[model samples]
Target: MKTVLITGATGFVGSHVLEAFMAQADPMLRVIAACRDRRKLLPGFAGEVREGDLRDADYRKIMVEGVDVLCNAVAWSSLWGHVADSRHLFLEPNLALIDAARAAGVRRFVNTSTTSAAAPEHSSDPQSEGIPRPLWPHLCNVVKIEAALRTAASADFQVINLRLGIFAGRRYALGVLPILVPRLKTHLVPWVAGGRTSLPIIDGRDIGAAFVCAVAAQGLADYEGFNIVGPEVPRVRDVITYLHDDYGLPKPHFSVPFAVAYPFAWLMEKLDPIVPWEPLVTRSIVHLMEEVGVDNAKAERLLGYRPAYAWRAAIHAQMQEMAVRQTRAMSMAMPIV
Candidate 1:
């Protein structure tokens, strides 16, 4: 029986990955859920659940015992506020996890990374491979985690840093999609500019499947940085249009040049460095207006990673799910006639 240890087992992606592994793997596989709070974990986790902070040496030592694989999904997923903890919020805990995993004799390690680290081709920065600065602290953790994994003393543990594109599905962060959906339905969220930026979206559930595949793979010498993107790319404009069509709302009014959006992004970034707890729009989102499509051929060939949902279908599915939720809410709110 394989023993798999998962960090961030309570988070959006982490929760799904835990479930996915349970479904695909043998019932005998020993799964350990290592998280900051075990009570926050999803209902009916079929394996051992351990409470531990990723940053603590003792926590690592306790959780990694007899664990053959480690999956890192822990992160600061806030949108704004808490600029002071940027370093600790991302780098410290992530670095600690990588170091501890190597020392613990874990055979395989899979780390979650977001696509925000990739620079657009038009970016003026000279260092293409080098991680760009001024990144959202959560996303920056991916880069730092990857670098740390590379430098870890050549141990038997093989690391796979899964660089994920925008992911949506059950329990996802109410990112651009959720925010835009309600606004577009009410005609509040505008397209702003042309909404020309192409978005590479991957289903949150499919991301779960990807992690399962990573765990199932026999060896990991060739498995490294792979961009997990949707099977097809969808422009932001089309996404908004689909929302308008789905909800039968008036087409969103457009204004505010793309250039103007940058300053709002700048202010949002300045106000919220680690996670934008409160902001009209944050830097990570501002960059959303910019193109972020990625090639997933490597992931396809390596991990047999294929998105289970299409971009448009996935977008509509999200809106549909939200609609069902709203309907339930409305039904519950009615005067019990």
Candidate 2:
């Protein structure tokens, strides 16, 4: 039987990945989930669960032992924490995990990366091609991680990096949407460049399926990269408008050009520490707005990844889930007779 171990199995993306593996009816596949907290493991999960920080050498040894494949989904995510924190909290741990996986004789290692790594200059075509420029600090760190993985991969071990697009759907805790939602409630978000920039988005479920494909794929190079995105690319204006309309909230009326908005976002990021809450805007968010489009064709051709949801359908599903949760919350809050 082939054994697959997933790190960050309790996190937003990781949880979905875990579910995908669990749903697999393959009796020959043994799935294990690793996270810091066992209590967070999915309800009714029957597989082996290992709880501990991957940074600990002993814990990593236990997690990788006899594992045929390793799916790394953990990240110390903070839109405000720029390069320094990213390197310290995210880059270091993940790179170390890669080395450990390689040494442990893991046949394949799958990593979760972001499409923003192809920033400063993006392509409109359906190909995974771009130059890495230091436009966004978070993506810069991802680029560094990708380079490290490439260097570490060998003929005996394979590394596959899936550069995922902006994520949405239930359990999505990071990305611009979570930050933008609250501001949108108060109509505080501005229409940067009339919000016409193409926002490449994918459902969390699709992302999980992509990971599953990576694990099962064959004849792949020792080191390879693929762009993972939704079937349809929606403009920012459409997404924002859909959110407002779905929730009966006011839409943003104000607008700003990229040149003007970028500086303002930089200033907001500078003042984030004292603000106590997340900044209404950040330089990283601004850089994301400049992305034209993402190509998922590479993933389709290479991994046979076929996304089931488009941006519109994904957003609608998320809003419906949110409404159900709100109704349940209100029911719980009502005073009993």
Tell me the TM-score of each prediction against the true structure. Answer: 0.82, 0.88
Q: What is the C-alpha local distance difference test score of each model?
A: 0.67, 0.77
Residue 265, model 1, lDDT:
62
Query: Which pairs clash (backbone N, Cα, C closer than 3 Å) in model 2?
Result: none
Instruction: Output the TM-score of candidate 1.
Output: 0.82
lDDT of 2 by residue, 53-164 (tens): 8778888888899999999988667565556766766778887888888888999999888777766365443234444555456566677778888788778888898888
RMSD of each: 6.2, 5.5
Query: Under the 3 Å rule for N, CA and C atoms, how many clashes does model 1 have?
Result: 6
Candidate 1 per-residue lDDT, tens place, 42-142, comes to 88775788896666778777878888888888756534434446456566877877767777788888888766666555222211232644545544555
- Cα deviation at 21, candidate 1, in Å, is 1.0
Off by over 4 Å in 1: 122-130, 153-155, 182-193, 248-252, 255-258, 267-277, 320-337
